[model samples]
Target chain A: MKQGPLDLSQHFLEEGVVDLSSSEKQSALEELCAITSKHAHVRDAKAFCKAIFEREKLVSTGIGLGVAIPHVKIPSVTDYVITVGRSEAGIDFDAIDGQPVRLVFMIAASEKQTAEFVRVLASIVKLVKQNDVRSRLLEASMPNEFCSILREASR
Target chain B: MNARTLVDHIRSSAATGRLLILCVIIGAIAGVFCVAFSWLLETVQYYLLDGLAHHESEHPVWIWLLVLPAFGGLVSGVLTTKFAPEAAGPGTDAAVDAYHHHGGRVRTRVPFIKMITAAVTLGTGGSAGREGPLTQIGGGIGSFVATGLRLSNQERRILMAAGMAAGIGAMFHAPLAGALFAAEILYREMDLEHEVIVPSFIASIIAYSIYAQKAGWEPVYAAPHFHFRNALQLLAYAALAIVLAASATLFTRLWRVVRDAFSSLPVPTALKPAIGGLIAGSIGVFVPDALGTGHHLLAGAFASSFSIGFLILLVTAKMVTTSLTIGSGASGGKLGPSLVLGGSLGSIVGLVVQDLFPSLEIDAGAFVVVGMAGFFAAAANTPISTIIMVSELTGNYQLLVPSMLVCVLAYLFVSRHGIYDAQLVSRLEAPSKMGNMLGAVLKTIAIRDAANHTRDLIVVPEAMSLRQIIDLYTSSEQLAFPMVDPDGKLTGMIEGRDIRRAIAEEGVADLVVARDLARPHEVIDIESTLLDAVQRMTLTGLEDLILVEAEDPTRPVGVLEHQEVLHAYDRKLMEK
Candidate 1:
């Protein structure tokens, strides 16, 4: 209940992380959104997935460094949330850098929770940019280990 | 003021200060040009008409007076039509149109072409003023200088106005009036282009001084000793205002009538001025006083030598001749004829008032000055310039009170109808003015200030059924609903538009899940500026964008609706 400097690792639950072999951008985004939907915070799975697809039509969220951030700020979110998916084969996301995205961070948050949402996104990007953090994240077998590595690097 | 110091100072100075210095230089150039133009016209007229044959003589060869103006008109028409067609008609209107619509860009050849055309037209006895051509020449110079330097649009517009003011100031030896004329002539209503006033005034003074050095420091006309006399004279001036206003209206209407008549004629467009010149030349030969700028006739009226009947005839003849000359596209101004008509009308009004009220010592000269100002105030919607210009031209500061009163009365009576059709309502209505205003506003504010907090919104679950979603959608006025999974992690969003589309489709009755039709929405960084958010929305064609944390691209914070951006803009405007 107490808000602090936002932690990116807090949003990544065990079920939120998944190994996705999907090559297409839309399917990868849908799988990530589905992973987040299983969390208690995700109130509407259909509405949430639709928002992500609609956002994709505008521009790809693939920010490069083998990372794609498909984010949505919707009224259906009760709190800030993020779903992490790792594809070793790399998904074909139309990123600005043009490299296939190996990591996808599908984030959804309540309309009012901008502070936490922004902080969480900044922490994730900072942690992911570290060569050690990225390599360890890819080597981690489970979502818990991936989240723990993120927590260590973010600190 | 040293040359080296001045150059260094200008290089280090700000844009506005640099522009003022440039205006002074432009004014000097314009002044020299105006004097040269006036001298050219006078010398040509003397050689062609006066020196060739005695204009006052009854010699049969003096019949050339009847054909000279027609020949001049033909030459002027050819010059205007061939090189710079925009130089045709009153040059002030063209200058005005350039400032309002053309970003103050006048063709380089316009000033030269107009000068030649106007000289020929007026030199050969065409009844029009040289003021219009000088104004265009000055404006052209300003446009040239500003364009050469690659100045901003706003700075260029100001310089153009300053150039026009310099021309009028130098031409008539009325620097203050000329400066005001440039600012006032841009609008038909009671509005001034105030930004140009200071630069224009500086330019006018510089130009006036240069012209005075060559032409001597004398007003354009000399008036007899005239006093305000008594309070009773105010009533007479008021009466003169009414007469001038009526005559001004009639003058404009007659000009239009003559022009329309010539336009509809079977003759070639270039030859129309020749025909007009023939009629005007015939009128001039009968009453030579009505020809040219009529400055001498105006001076004669102030001396109180003309009989009442002769003054009336001069007014009618001057009006008709001016209409014929300018209406045929001879490339001269209406200001000189307007002053002539107003002065003659005032002379008549003065005579009648003195005769009717025997006790009142109403000087006819005072009436003449007031009449000149009043008629132009109504006809050209230039009350301030008319008062100052008339007083300056005659060196009669004592007549200011009466001139102001008459000018106001006439200006009010004439309202929106004026001689310059290119004049707009105000600077506020100009496209360039609005663009500058809006651009300045958009630059000051950022997107962070306009964003709303995410805690203020309603969050919907991604598990909600379509029927339940429909019930909630129908119950509330919310346009967008953010979705989350069972573990409370954000997934996507559903908008009212998506729901409507689904309902319109067939075989979708059982497909009620909120996630099935969810679409991606644009995401904006919370740290991004408000202008960036607005630009993104415009670029992506979205009415709303989702705000995310700057550090974490995947995390959503709040929704920034288009209406909210507009509301912020409205608030900023109100503050302004």
Candidate 2:
């Protein structure tokens, strides 16, 4: 229910945090969609990937600080969802600061999910704004380590 | 030029070899349907109005006149509101809407429901026209027959127009004008639906012949022989055109205002029409000429017995009563009432002109005919067809020069405001012609050039209460509000749908803030191509409402509306 705050920790699955070997920004989005599409909320993985790429065409969602957050609100996305894909090589995301994106945070929300969608998005904004959050997230070598850092930082 | 030139009106216009045959079949059926509707209208009017109230007689029974239309409105209202709301208001607009938006699809039951309901509304003295109801009815027939034959969407739309032509041609007894009306009425500007012209002609001729065979080949109004020879008469005709243009504008605006007022009432939608009929009936108690479609008054105005003062009063009364009856969700058309309003006003102007030019032998009846054509031409944005339609309806072939001048003048004077709201600006903008939007134009324009710039942007503060946002939503036209944090940095955005969903889900608005309702909104850089924005908009099923920003997308600069992109694209194509 959108009336109450979303439990951020429960939504971040350890398996979803992947060390993505993507050469381009588009490939990075594909890798994240493949992982997120496996979740119960996404109706189709291929369509979701296509939608994310389409959203990227307008303007790069890569906010500064080596973080590219590509998000879409679509009918295919039945609930609030997120997946983290880290490209160690740092793909060029055309960010305003000209920083190569080391971390790709993908968000997918339902067309109708208002409160919970906004809550998840705002939490990500807060998490990305943390002083050392990106460096800590990039340095983590394993998926479980990445999850723990996110969980602890969020708490 | 010798007889009939099978000319290709447009380069891309569909080949009408098989379509012509279908038009013949559809036209025949639509013609018989028109005759049946006319007969039904007359039978009901004779029994109900003549028997119960003595409607047209001198010193008529008053109480019966007041109750009959209200009762008729109650029945017709329930029929349209309960079973077929598509039949509500003017039927011609619904028919045009279906052609342009609904892929030429009309539900199977709409025609049958419309026929019965429209007859009831007109027969019991509701101040509405037969054109709208019959157009929808005939259009439904065409849609049905075309769908049965497994036609394409384009073919179906063509057939639908043919049916419309048949209905108008048969009912108004003006076959050629009816065909032209069907094609011309679909667009507001000087443009016509060129593809529909020939097929409509075929259907209209067939329908008119069949109806004439049964109902006698007489024009609706018989006018005395009147000539327009004097050069001084142009002055009078021009003044008539200007006044008629003004009256047409007034009629269209009045219709919308009255329609909105009735819709805003808390009563059941079905009961609204009954209330409208009650008001019209009360007006009819003093002026019975306004109670029904004012066709008979047009005939009377041309005769010698009717005074100029009475004709002027009839014009005002007809405009008011027709606005009340049809605007309140009753099934009817504006075309028939417009004829009466224009005819009476023209007659009044003609008398005034005759007084001015006492030395010249001038015929006032010529103005009556030209006035009918001119008033409708401006009101409905159908100049060419209305001239021919009015001429044939009056059997007045001698006044073509005056009719043409008046119709064209009135059309130019009124410009774009007309009765049919569904009429598109031009063929380029019609939804039915989506294929005309070349894909190459999309790649030619940039977001910076096409995006809409607004000075009064409504930016919702993240800390602002959701209750405050709701108030903003009510007061402003902005669809998406950009949400800024305490530092005034763009954090997120709240779409119009987000607020609607929150209200639908019954979220506590007082407790939630703008931050709680804002989603991770998509923004486009000013450098993006129109094609890039369009691809995203279509794939995501979102509007062309992406925010435009500078180097940093979060720093919003403008809003890219899809309409502006389309306008730019259309302009580019025009340059080619």
Point to the candidate with the largest DockQ. Answer: 2
Tens digits of lDDT, candidate 1, B1-576: 899999887776777788999998899889889888988898878877565534544452346668877988898888888898888878888999999999999999999999888998888888899888888999999999999999987888999999999999999899999999999999998888888999999999999999999998988886637768588778888888889988999998999899889879898767878889899989877787777778777777887788999998899999999999988888899888888889899999998997899688888877888888899999999998888999899898888899999999999887577888889987778877885666566557666677564666555665465566777778765566667666655566666666665444332222235554454557788767667776787786666777777676555677777777777888999997
Compared with the true structure, all predictions reach lDDT values of 0.80, 0.82
Model 2 ranges with Cα > 4 A deviation: A1-155, B1-15, B439-576
Q: Using lDDT as the measure, which candidate wins?
A: 2
Candidate 2 residue-wise lDDT, B524-570, digit = tens: 77787888788777775555354655666666666666677778887
Count of clashing residue pairs in every prediction: 56, 0
Tens digit of lDDT per residue, candidate 1, span A1-155? Answer: 22233455555677777889687887888778888877777788899899788766555667678987777667787876777899999988987688998988787877555333444544565566677777888999886798787666655
Tens-place lDDT per residue, model 2, A30-90, is: 7888999999899977788886786676456777778777777667889877788888789
| Native contacts recovered, each model | 0.00, 0.19
Among all windows of 10 consecutive residues in model 2 chain B, the one with the lowest summed lDDT is B3-12
Instruction: Report clash pairs, candidate 2.
Output: none
